[model samples]
Target: GSDGSPQWGTSAEDRDPPGGDRSNHTACPKQRTVHKCELLHVAIVCAGHNASRDVVTLVKSILFHRKNPLHFHFITDSVAHQILQTLFQSWMVPSVHVSFYNADDLKPEVSWIPNKHYSGIYGLMKLTLTKALPSNLSKVIVLDTDITFATDIAELWAVFGKFSEKQVIGLVENQSDWYLGNLWKNHKPWPALGRGFNTGVILLLLDRLRHLGWEQMWRLTAERELMNMLSTSLADQDIFNAVIKQDPSLVYRLPCFWNVQLSDHTRSEQCYTELSDLKVIHWNSPKKLRVKNKHVEFFRNLYLTFLEYDGNLLRRELFGCVRLTVTLPPTLQQALEELDEDDPCYDFRQQHLMQHRIHLFFLQYEFLALPNPTDVTLVAQLSMDRLQMLEAICKHWAGPISLALYMSDAEAQQFLRYAQASEVLSARRNVAYHIVYKEGQFYPINLLRNVALANTQTPYVFLTDIDFLPMYGLYDYLRNSIQQLELPQRKAALIVPAFETLHYRLTFPKSKAELLSMLDMGSLYTFRYHVWPKGHAPTDYAKWRTATVPYRVAWQPDFEPYVVVRRDCPKYDQRFVGFGWNKVSHIMELDAQEYELLVLPNAFMIHMPHAPSFDISKFRLSAGYRGCLQTLREEFHQDLSRRYGAAALKYLTAERSL
Candidate 1:
């Protein structure tokens, strides 16, 4: 064991052999035997808005150098989780699998340990690694989001095998003199061993750490150290070193090349003699690539190479066939079941957190070629049946369209073929299709809307349904109205009057004047005029007929008219899934936020008739479905009251009183 050979463990002989089911095979075979490559497990604690990009570049670097497959455990918040899931799903790298654990789940474990680091609680999440990861995972390589690998990750994974019997972690020594208390006179730092250890890159023997009761050990060390130090300035790193200071045998020292620290005060020269020997580059400073180091340019260039690398080239044959059905994990399913049925939005919240297999930005052939500054983007969601309408919408708008399409695997393949054959859909380059595969019987309409809205790249977004045909030149009219009216400076939504006609063969209206003519002729009626008059009554179509300019409209109950608003407006609530209240809930939220809804005199949208959706049909036929919808509606109003105060719900209260 002292000769540096791998020490599997004291009970290594009791474990099964490396190759599986060797009992049936002869001692030697004629052909060379191929052994399946073991998956390299890696964990990263990535939180905040800007961490997704850094983590993506880090993962790309690992995939570039490692020949074997990888399994990534991302301890992230909701924002980073959604972004990363969309990216990795679309990238479709054959050798990569990603699982996300909510950072909030581990907050209780480290919340007691006060941290002064900018990352705060997220930085301390690493201390709960033994509890955060699955129990089956015995070993994992944990890396900081600010690192890029220059060598195969397998070489780093191999370090775990070299850990001595008493060692539970493998890490590089800190390449700085801050711990020596010599930076300034009377400097005091958290207790640490000689030079301490850098946690930027770690080989965590999770099984061993769990056996050693890591949670209690770290807590005791932190509690004792906090008494004298007041608080930890370096988060998990400080506690890790403190624990090691008590027992040095708990850590195995990794080579300096594995973590070339690039902090402004780093003394890396003492650990490495040449740049060529560096296996990993760690920009451990807040300044990142801009940190002041002797070899800053070299390290910066290495990080940029991975940053600019083409992710498409790293694509390979998918690891497995597309799953026909996506079953919610037991944890998610139990969470959903335990939700208060009376809480209308609980399911919606769960759906947002649910790990559904999504492929984002699936096809965007002309996204990059479009002009940089577009005025408005059409954001909508649809199923495969709506594929035929894209050509017409794209040709009419002739601007940007961020679409979320829900379909099965078979339907997606069919739609791809359909897009290739149609000239309008194929030649146009400004549309982005984000595919959300089928999950359950109910369609996640609001989730689709959020996906489309989130991906819109324009300054303003025209939120509408895919079944509506915009009045000709609507895009230009809205763009000119926005500038002429100065809508951007104010909290406003430019409402486009919507109409519906039963006659499908009639020529679509091109101008507001012609639309009024049809209105007079009794061919087209205001959308849902008879069944759901309140839905569009707030737009005041009677006044819109004579008004020549944009007019402000008061927020009214059940108002869900289509509108053009800023890209950063409040998102649709995912709880109002199925039929009924999805769009109405969003309208209510906008009202609560005090957004002025202004009716545009020139622009309009006409609905094209189509068969009812499955959700709508269920709502009509099943009393249980209708009851659920009513319960959700009440809960949503209560939520709005709580979020924006009772003043925000005055309209609803007034309507009920009437």
Candidate 2:
């Protein structure tokens, strides 16, 4: 069978002799032929009680591209069988057969294959297929559930014909040699650079692997010391690398585009330029299933698009509860099973992603209703350095906005000139740009804030930084909430917290709600507000929402960056000229006036991703910071002394700005 001869010839006329010896391969009809193009056998492992939905999605993606005929044998657990059966039955085609084989049923054969690690045990399920699957399955293309086929899977099956006499498996090479780096210390024969592959995608010669003694490979995994030596972060990947290393001739490396993983993205930029030619995309990273962010959703949506579920009712019926469910292995599955949904440590980011996709589904039809877009004005103070962010901010928001840009020296003015000439300002007529020229590297931020405040004509003003993006329906909701408040409550300052995204890019394709889907809810924390009891602000929107009147602001400081206030509220203290202690001084003044600070429920601005602008060491030594401290003492000391006596001024320099 190792000889370069087709076990089942392509022609319908090819036949084996009647009652011929069938010991070498699985016994089939003695006079039967299989046209390779007409039928294909694809085996996918979804063991360790993983999600059935993802496997269904993978199958749908494969079926979308291939029209001829397909037989997909799924190796999974009993828990997933019912769902898989229900899903595949609905998607069944005339020439396709969807079959499931529980990995537990094959336990007797692989009993010698030690369950050293759960991941390694799960990986061994693929090896058991030769004994577990029907004997007629000689050549099977194995795939991980995380993969989606972009090209017809029949094309991938054809790669089997390209294999040499010695080649027992067909797989794309690993994008990098990072996986093989450990073999250097063991003095083992490592795969050549770019020859190692992620086991996410593989075309296995099941009959040959059986002939080559799959039981012996089982014994190799059972050895404790050897398993420890072979162990990597990815337990199974390391073992597979060693197997291929011992017998490199057994594998035939296909083109890189066949199994493109995240690591493969480092290939020439031309790979993306020629994306249409890509056959398969494997999201082999564990995070791909756990973290449901925009990047992960991008590929998932591509798979879903090809699935092409008809009508909104059908889409909701299928994916309503199934969205964000992942096919996790044993370790993660156990961990997730142990954690409650409401627990502080529990991860619900994926659920948020599902909500966003559902939101996008609704966003397709309904017109966004804004009560009065002209009544409220968004005021932002920014330095000229973040001009692109300013442009993006304006483009994202539909209503009128005011930008107070502090130009620090000639370079900033030059940037302004470039922005003026460019489409940044010209395309958006509702945006009002107010440039304040100053002569230093550190622009006068507090002065800029006051300038922006002075320029706003609206009765209600939302003061925020240039990078913060308001969530969808915020404008309409704010308008309705403001209208509901009593005359005295209307004068209150609406406090909204800012949540930061852990990204560096300034652009987003989706709305703020969609972007919020990417953030881990457990990791979401508010910015530090100095004047709060614990030096970090905590929002209690429940008190404000349920109370008859606006929630009273007694001691809480107003961090003005994401607060909406009446036009007549106290302005930002211009005396505190630089970054530190500027916004809090204004907040302290608002608190001094006893203006109510109502924390709006379920509404907040998202901070666009960006690195800190100032270097800490240099900023501490700068004249701006030095002058800021003196100005802070002079301005805050008087207010602190008058408001709560001279004793309160003790914290003036002792507790510096964060």
What is candidate 2's lDDT per residue for 503-604, written digit by digit as tens? 555344244344345433433334442223332243553353344443544444333435777777787765454446667677666655656767666566
TM-score for each predicted model, relative to the true structure: 0.55, 0.39
Candidate 2 minimal-lDDT segment of 10 residues: 355-364
Q: With candidate 2 superimposed using the best TM-score fit, by how many Å does residue 485's alpha carbon deviate from the native?
A: 52
TM-score of 2: 0.39
Poorest 10 consecutive residues by lDDT, candidate 1: 28-37
Highest TM-score against the true fold, candidate: 1
The total number of steric clashes, by the backbone 3 Å criterion, in model 2 comes to 1
Relative to the true structure, how large is the alpha-carbon lDDT of every model? Answer: 0.80, 0.57
TM-score quality measure for candidate 1: 0.55
